[model samples]
Target: VISSFKIADIGTVDLDTIGTVEAGGMTVEVIDPVADYAELMESLFDFDALRALFKSGFRMRFDAMHAVTGPYAKEILENRLGAPNGTARNFIPLPDFGGHHPDPNLVHAKHLYDEMMGPDAPDFGAASDGDGDRNLIIGKGIFVTPSDSVAMLAANAHLAPGYKAGLKGIARSMPTSGAADRVAEKLGIGIYETPTGWKFFGNLLDADMATICGEESAGTGSNHVREKDGLWAVLLWLNILAARGESAKQIVTEHWAAYGRNYYSRHDYEEVETD
Candidate 1:
């Protein structure tokens, strides 16, 4: 038996199955994974606090890139959290992602980036990848690098009910910047540097040694689940925003002032022939 995930591969499957899909018809038990996931998400934060952010008229724009997270964002951010209608854009999952790649980076999600940088931008803007594990964060006129995001999230995570006790430790992929390391230092918690994969962080998380883990690839999560969760990161950010009563830019600026900022960048090359 083979199990597959992510839109890149899953979209190719023959979804319309006839009765007896395989030898001796397999029983398909349908379940509402979205409701289950939404419940789990709500458990991780102070509901009233997050609702207050929206109640206070702080606008949020989440671009799903027409990928998997559209429904989840719609349910959590709009239905559950009381955000205004149309808060989640490109919210219908399309197999071909409307003829464009569904990566939530500046290159692919450029429309969202442009809107966030525009003069009439919302207070907060975010995007998630097709598979719904990676994310992109932009605030009004500022783009929060994944490296700095991890650090900032780690610093303010306590504002969320799930992490109110504080993080046990922080783990980052090897290529990730040392920004999180500074956060770990200031918090006096353990810091781990592992290879570039979620699997490596799993062990540390299971051991209770690391409460939060992240990669510069825009993946971030906690011990709450094994794999990185994109909406989870978004909700946590909202929880922090609500508790702080500050704009995304203000929080980021203050985080830099407190931790001393780290400037960094990366480049990727494709089709390089190696001997």
Candidate 2:
């Protein structure tokens, strides 16, 4: 297979293992085989589409981990958010310092939590699990449950850069807290509750009828991707920050002070047998 060959063994490989080749400085390189069709389709997204979307005020939310993909997502968000030179500090990338785990939570992501609570903290602070799918939302000294986060996004949708086009609908996973339903009710918009997996929301998002989808496990995203994204939620929070001209903490504090504090929490049990 193509993966079995070393960089130097490209030219010596037989036809069956060959994919593609390039020659430079007396060296031949073989390309890895295509992993999946969907990846190829995703690569077809053009830079101009991003530029146009950003110009029209399209934004992204995402979670940042220590992995390379996290930085890649940040770069994309900066470019779309009109940051100069494609650099922004709202969701700055922290190095894998002191063997830290990049998960986003009060228990596991203490560094980010501390910063968010401190003076001069970022307008928004967000983190992702190892794979950049899970998210934790923090605003000035408090953590937002994913249910509240997604609902807040819906309630504040019109304040986002591009959401003036208006949200088509809202959706949440079955286990998610029911906050978004209130937002939907207030806005006179549709709300859908599906199974735990994000894939079930595909039909709604694909229909251009839903602008946000979230799960109770700290996962959130918009119509941007079919999968739940931590960083995407972060960017959405920043979009609100930019629009409101408020710190993350201030915004959430105002929210709770007005909403009377839902006081939501979760408990998990391990190895429970269904039988």
Best by lDDT: 1
Lowest summed lDDT window (length 10), candidate 2: 33-42
Clashes of each: 0, 10
lDDT of model 2 at position 104: 65
User: Could you tell me which residue pairs clash in candidate 2?
Assistant: 61-231, 61-232, 61-233, 61-235, 62-230, 62-231, 62-232, 63-230, 63-231, 140-249
Q: Which sections of candidate 2 miss by over 4 Å?
A: 1-63, 73-102, 119-122, 257-261, 268-275
| Ten contiguous residues minimizing lDDT sum, candidate 1 | 6-15
RMSD (Cα, Å) for all candidates, in order, is 5.8, 8.6
lDDT of all predictions, in order shown? Answer: 0.88, 0.64
lDDT (Cα, tens digit) per residue for candidate 1, span 1-275: 66876433222223454333232234443457778899998889988888887988989899898999999999988898899999999999999998888888888888888999998999999999999999999998999999888899999999988899999999999999999999999999999999998999999999999998999999999999878988888888888888988888999999889888889786756359876
For model 1 the TM-score comes to 0.87
Clashing pairs in 1: none
